[model samples]
Target: MSNAAVLWRRVVAEAVGTGLLVTVVVGSGIAASSLSPGDVGLQLLENSFATALGLGVLILMLGPVSGAHFNPVVSAVDWWLGRRTGAGLTSRELTAYVPAQIVGAIAGAVLANLMYAKAAVSWSTTDRSTGHLWLGEIVATAGLIVLIFALGWSGRAAVAPAAVGAYIGAAYWFTSSTSFANPAVSIGRAFSDTFAGIAPGSLVGFVVAQLFGAVVGVGLLAILYPDAGRAADEIVTPHTDTTTTGATT
Candidate 1:
């Protein structure tokens, strides 16, 4: 296959993978709220479990096609870590992947809303803006990056699907923000005024915190695993397609 075709396939994988991820998040949240009505704790448990299972399955399904990033921060971190050694995504792939992920995420949220008979693009009223919440986002995102890169560096990529899913599920309880660690997910959640949504007004802070968290995660990786960059291409999981050459991730 041509390089262009391969890139196109990867972009589609990222989009579809991310979209489904958001669907799992928003849809499960809606269902959880409906099922557990007044029991906030039970609702969260349902949402988290469903998200964890869905995410792991999605990663397993799409990892070979696109690394299953599903998050812009993950893609960007891949680019940054591999820029010097050319182990991860190229600039072109990064540009293509990020937008596709974002658009896919938004579409996923809308799909979730429609599925539940809610208005599409309801614009979340759940405002999550606050210093502590931003801190939670930073901590959640940083930990995610560290966990993902650590697995890659340690040649444990095979378990990334389970490990990542478990981490996010746990973070849902541990973090104050319920770990909306992905900027694309954060944006996508804004389109739904449901249990999983974040108000549009709070997006900037969450996104900024996530970006900052990525930077922190990278720094920590540098210190803890100085050779982490060597495994950049294998992040999330290794891909079989070599059509993109050195920019597989």
Candidate 2:
């Protein structure tokens, strides 16, 4: 496809994938809370599992077209990892993507909140004490990034979507933060005062922890899969030169 066509496709994929992710996440959160009142842990678990399934499906559906970067953190990390080594979205395009995700998330939260009366939607308060919550965020986000990079970027794993789904589902049980690995998703859920809300003040800790986890994941991947990143130039440079030679000849 032409560059313009590819760019448009990528944008559409991102928008649709992100929109679906947020909607399902918030919707599931609300559903869990309504079904099981006062059982915050179970509610969060349900939300996490649903999110994982939703994300996996969306990624599988959109990975071929746009890489399915439904979160800004993933997009930024992919760029930093040099995965966008060749003709990909520009800074301007990336800048636009985050806002679209945030907007979509907010819309999702609003719709979910409306589904279940706003008054019934209570903010999250399941032992997110300052210290414990921060620690949980760190562990949760780290695992998520590791899974994404390992299965999606490394190209060694078969059925990346299934791998990601399992990782998320496991992370929810293992990590204290219940596996809220995406900063955008975390912040977006905050808008809805439902089972997913992080108590506005809690957002800072979650975002910070998530960013730290991303950096850690990148570092670990660098060490564990050093050659994974080397493919970009090796493939692109040779292909470009070959094309040029063909044109000249």
Candidate 3:
């Protein structure tokens, strides 16, 4: 295949993976809400479990294709850290990946709502704007970045499916904002009005917090694993895996 063709394939994989991820996240939440009725904790448990399993599977399936970076923040961090190292994505890939992830995430939410027989594009009313919530976002996103990059440095790339999945599951409970660490996913959730949704009005602050968290994550990487910022012969990001197909988490 030509280089352009390869790039397009990767881009397509990213879009599909992200879309499916949102489908799993939003769909499960909607179902959980209905099944559990008024039990908030149960609903959250159902949603978190489904997300953990589904995300891990998606990463395993698509990582070899586009590094399965369903999250834009992950893609950005990967590109930033790996720009100089051949282990990371090129600028063109970074540009392509982030947009694909966002588009896919939105599509996924639409699909989830439709599957639940709801409106295709209703905005969420769940207002999550608050100082403490923003702080939670920053904490969640920063921890995510730190863990992912740290895996690369530790030469534990193969465990990313379990590690990343588990961390997200834990973050959902420990963090106040339910850990909307993925910017693309959060934007997509804004278009949903179901249990997993976030208010559109709150997107700006959440995204800002996430970005700041990414910076903090990078700083931590420098301190704990100074050499992890650049890619090495090993996989540079959590998105890449042991498969020859180039699967990412």
Cα-based lDDT for every prediction = 0.93, 0.65, 0.84
By lDDT, the candidates rank as 1, 3, 2
- Report the alpha-carbon TM-score of model 2 versus the true structure: 0.79
Q: What are the per-model numbers of colliding residue pairs? A: 0, 0, 9
Show where candidate 3 strays beyond 4 Å.
232-249
The C-alpha TM-scores of every prediction are 0.97, 0.79, 0.93
- Using TM-score as the measure, name the better of candidate 1 and candidate 2: 1
lDDT of 3 by residue, 57-159 (tens): 9888887666677888887887777766655677788899899999999999999999999999999999999989999999999999888888878888777
Q: Give the lDDT of residue 91 in candidate 2.
A: 68
Residue ranges of candidate 2 with Cα displaced over 4 Å = 83-90, 117-129, 230-249
Q: Please name the candidate that would achieve the greatest lDDT relative to the true structure.
A: 1
Between prediction 1 and prediction 3, which has the larger lDDT?
1
Over 119-181, each residue of candidate 1 has an lDDT whose tens digit, in order, gives 988999998989999999999999999999999999999999999999999999999999989
Ten residues in a row with the worst lDDT in model 3? Answer: 232-241
* RMSD versus native structure for model 3: 2.8
| Stretches of model 1 off by over 4 angstroms after superposition | 242-249
Determine which window of 10 residues in candidate 2 has minimal summed lDDT.
Answer: 234-243
